[model samples]
Target: MTHTTLSTAQRDRAAGVLLGLACGDALGAGYEFGAPLPDHTPVRMQGGGGFGWAPGEWTDDTSMAIPLARAAAAGLDLRDETVLDGIVAQWVDWAKTAPDVGVQLRAVLSRTEPTASAVRQVAKAHHDRHGRSAGNGSLMRTAPVALAYLHDPAALAEAARLVSSLTHYEADAGDACVLWCLAIRHAVLEGELDLRIGLPALPADRRALWEGRFAVAETSRPADFARNGWVVEALQGAWSAIVTTPATDATHLRLALDAAVRGGRDTDTVAAIAGGLLGARWGASAVPAEWRRIVHGWPGLTAADLLRLGSSATPDLAHAQAESVDYAYLGDVSTLVRHPHDDGVWLGAAGALDALSAEIDAVVSLCRVGTKQVPTRIRHRVEVRLIDDDDPAKNPNLDVVLLDTVQVVAALRAEGHTVLLHCAQAQSRTPSVAALYAAVHRGVPIDRALAEVIAALPAAAPKRFLRDAVVRLAEANTDSPHQGPNTEGARA
Candidate 1:
């Protein structure tokens, strides 16, 4: 692979914005309510804090930011209902089982409106019923908006405020979002922190309010900023940590993370806020490698995944393409490519028929995970829900269901039918099932079969969850006789 001419600092800050947020969130997870951490060594992701999250697992802060980052990366207009609807969908889905959710956020998310105006009304209603409406929930997840609009300072400010109104309509919450996003954008684009640049984006009345706050941030301890749920206090705590810590040393990010967690209240959010600025100033590489390896979130995104996502959010790197299918064979088994696996049967995208041979005897569709879509064009159609790892929690019988479909594929091959397994993209689902069939029915070892499958399909990468599921099923039935198939290796 060739490298882009982009500077190392540019790449680092780009990936840093999101990865930093996750690192801080995970690092502070276990210390949310505990005694303040010492400022000597940096905080680690030692799970079992107030939320009982696993080590390196982030919370709602990073989870809620994902859809926004994806939204900005796709260039969706934030003012549009479709864009807001996408954000709402991710929020609702996460809230379904989120271990922690703020009271006002819960009420606002409960309403099924996709418009910013509607969400604002819902938030106002919640505030009327409850006590306070302004919380750090909105600001905690606002860092991605900065990455999404890194080049345009004005647009970035506008988006930061608009997105905040989704659940936090208070002007201070919106102003905090604007200030933090501008700070992140500056750090990402200019490689330094300049909180003053966001002043023009804030409401004229609130300008004086933030000026005094910034002065306090420069000299105060993180504890003086208060780790409460209030948005102003959240920004104060996060910025105090950022400004007080020395950003010059090689371990500047570590010092900042330590300061944010030292307060011991709302540790995750405060650290997350500080992480964004620190990451923006330093770059993703500034975060400790040990912490990066373990940091993950509800979106199934590890720090590495988030780094890739953040880098992709850069405007010069963004591109749009129509879906195309590539054809290859996993040993004797044929493969068709898509996003998720297609149960090792021949399936093509809507316009990828050119690459796929029109002479296919059968097709198995495993797109959409749980919902099986039976094919009508092919003579023999096998439906299998070989879902990705993300869906396993929702569908517990995924392994058994996949095993049954593998047997069915073996049976079809024995009956002398050439087949193609396809999913939405054939990237993970289709290739995984193809490799599994090679291992189980064709007597190939799992590793060798996987190597062959990926080698044959250069575009395909292994999906560990699907592969493990298939391997577990294969190991369970290893002692049983192979009675379904007719050949030593069934050719698809």
Candidate 2:
């Protein structure tokens, strides 16, 4: 498949696929195999399931998908047998030490040599012997297949089936993968959900069967699919959770995944499945920063790694490292001024990071910096991905990113850690975020906060778009009940 250039929205959605999947996997990890959760019960990544997952840690569902994501990111075709073999080899290595593995996948991997041909033979033999191999295992990790062939629906359908056949020979498993992958592709490209879009690509009989399944899902709730361990029911349960939930805004991504977890049995798999589509439709920007901050698992990967993998999977969307800036050319990089309302928070330019004081244990970076720019001694450091540009397209999740950054700063300060908030210069991004922090956390009016923040930073001049966003955030906060600054709570 040739690389297809993606729009900003398309790029964000493409990166969101794996992120959404991991977030859902971690969220549901603590509830796997449990009965349905009661309505209004708060769903958190508390982490106490059969596998003893750490809070916000993803499970085998994401672990199994990583190799495929890595391959796609490296620009390898998923339909190629050699690439599939490499994926199987990685899975074999992962299974040896994985905290948890699916029963069917374990049966095949444990007994066979780690080769595509050998693994397929063992999988076929297992299916033939028991007449049942349509487990949810294949479908759970099929999200990356969609990213590999987003430009061609026909190739996507073929690759989805071929990849699924590596460990699941059943037609049901392959069909479910094809439909779900096609749906994810559609969501990423078209910004909509349509499970039936790939129906015609399947055999006529199977197409009809899937159509009926979708019907059942649309009319019911995720909890209605009691046998979620099966591939068909897993798809139904995931789709039901998505369609049943009202996606009025980006928060729908979280709500739908929560609904999937509440569907009871095999909570992690179902939620992970739903998350792929939801993330594709909403973009990585739609995912909550709280989840992005903590979600990690398998092979020692973090949320940032997931974002990189997902972006790299789409060759055209591969992120280029930010160009290094000459700190010497920019005037006085050491301008550190205390926040007007909160003395514990210091506002400054990137140069201030050259010699951070011992009192500042936390740092919120608004500009891109080198790997070692932040001191190792700092206990908390959040590198916000806010670009120093006025173009709306440059910062798709401007509002969310801005608020989340302020919240992180406030949370850090509330925990009694002095915080440093800075950008490349003390100009656009830094002062804007600092002012936002004052408005929301310090309970100052938006205009007064901006004026105070400007007065503190002599060179402060926020761009039109960012300044507008601050005003909007302040208005929204004022319209609602004033919650204290630490709304998101301290980071783990």
Candidate 3:
């Protein structure tokens, strides 16, 4: 199936599929198979489940999905027999010594040859003997199938079933994959959560049945689905967590997944299932920087690898160029100045790294920099993906990225580390982010913060888009309850 070019919003949502999956998987890895926690309890990725997972480490749910994501990233048609066979081969290889594998999937994969046909036959025969093969295993890894056929719902439905059938032969399992994949596709394109959008794609006989299941999900809590090991209940549990949660913005993505994890048994699988759809709706920007910094899993992949794979899987995403930059024309790239509101923070261009004082122990980079741009001695270095362009489309998650970047700086400073914040030139991204940091963390008015920051850096001139975002964030912050640095008598 051919796909047309995607808008920036569409691209971000598309890239979020696997990213959200990994975040949910890792967050819930530590709490798997436990009873539901009391409401309002904090959920963290402090790993140590039945399988000893490291903090921020994903389990088999994401591990199983990686092969499909890799294939989609390679531009292969997911429904093609050759592609399916290759996916099966990868799964077989992964199961050899993987730390964790689902019981149903391990049974099917262990008995069959690595080929697609062999796996399908063995799966069907196993189902025939057991009279049931509707484990949630297949549904947990079905997120990537949506990325391959974002524009072709019919093909997506067919591919989802075919892929699920490779290890799960039950109709319920196939139907669940079809619904979830279609929901992900719709979420990516429309930025809304509507699972019923896929109902027409399912067989007419099964439409009402699934609709009723969705109705039950809406009325129930995630813990209501006690038999979550079954694919039907798993879908219900995931959907319940999503609908029951209230969100005013993209933070819904994190809160809903927290709801899923708190639902108890099979925590990782349920949360991973919800995360794919949440990521599709909110884009990668909605994910927290703290979580993105550490989430890693199978085959030695990090969050950045997942971002690349997700972006590559979607067609027509405009990637930023990695061409070498000429800093000589920009006059002085090394003009360093202390933040007007906080003495702990330093502001400058990328060139400021050349003569960093020993006091600067943390670095927050806003633009692309060389691998060795920051000194190795700086133990805490964060790279924020903020483009200098004024077009909103150029930076799809502009506001979220800005807020997250400043939060990173705030976090570093709260740890008592002096920080150096910089971009390519002190003109656009650097000044804008510095101003935001002052407004957010020092409790200074944004306009005053911008003026003070611009005064400190003679070359500072923020982009129109960034300036507008700063104003919006400042107004929003004023309305919300916030605790920042004690600025009672601090310098403006």
Best by TM-score: 2
- For candidate 3, lDDT tens digit of each residue in 1-492? 477478777877888899999999999999999998877899998999989999989999999999999888777998899999999999999999988899899998898789999999999998999999999999999999999988799999999999999999999999999999999999999888999999998999999999999999999999888889899999999999999999677778889999999899999999999999999998877777778767999998877668768887865752422233446577889889999899999999888988999999988878765545678798677767677887766676677788888898898899899999998888888878888888888888876787788878868877777777887887787653333432232233
Decoy 2 TM-score against native: 0.90
Give lDDT tens digits, candidate 2, residues 131-193. Answer: 999999999999998999888899999999999999999999999999999999999898889
CA lDDT scores, all candidates in order: 0.69, 0.86, 0.86
Off by over 4 Å in 3: 318-399, 415-420, 443-448, 475-492
TM-score of structure candidate 1: 0.63
Backbone clash count, each prediction separately: 18, 0, 0
Quality of model 2 by C-alpha lDDT: 0.86
lDDT order, best first, reads 3, 2, 1
Q: Return the lDDT, model 2, position 427.
A: 79
Please give the RMSD to the true structure for each candidate, in Å: 14.2, 4.9, 4.2
Better of 1 and 2 by lDDT: 2
The candidate scoring highest on lDDT is 3
lDDT per residue for candidate 1 within 1-492, as digits (tens), equals: 112233445656777888899989998888886666556645667998877899989988888988987876666666576688778877987887999887778878877555556777887777777766688999999998887776567777887887888788677888999999998888876777888889988778888989998898788878775545788888888888887887664367778888889877888999999898888887765666457646888877665457657776765544212132222222322334421223334434322333456556665555421211223355555434344555443333455456655666677667676666666555666667776777678776655555556555534654667656756666666643323322222223
Better structure of 2 and 3 per TM-score: 2
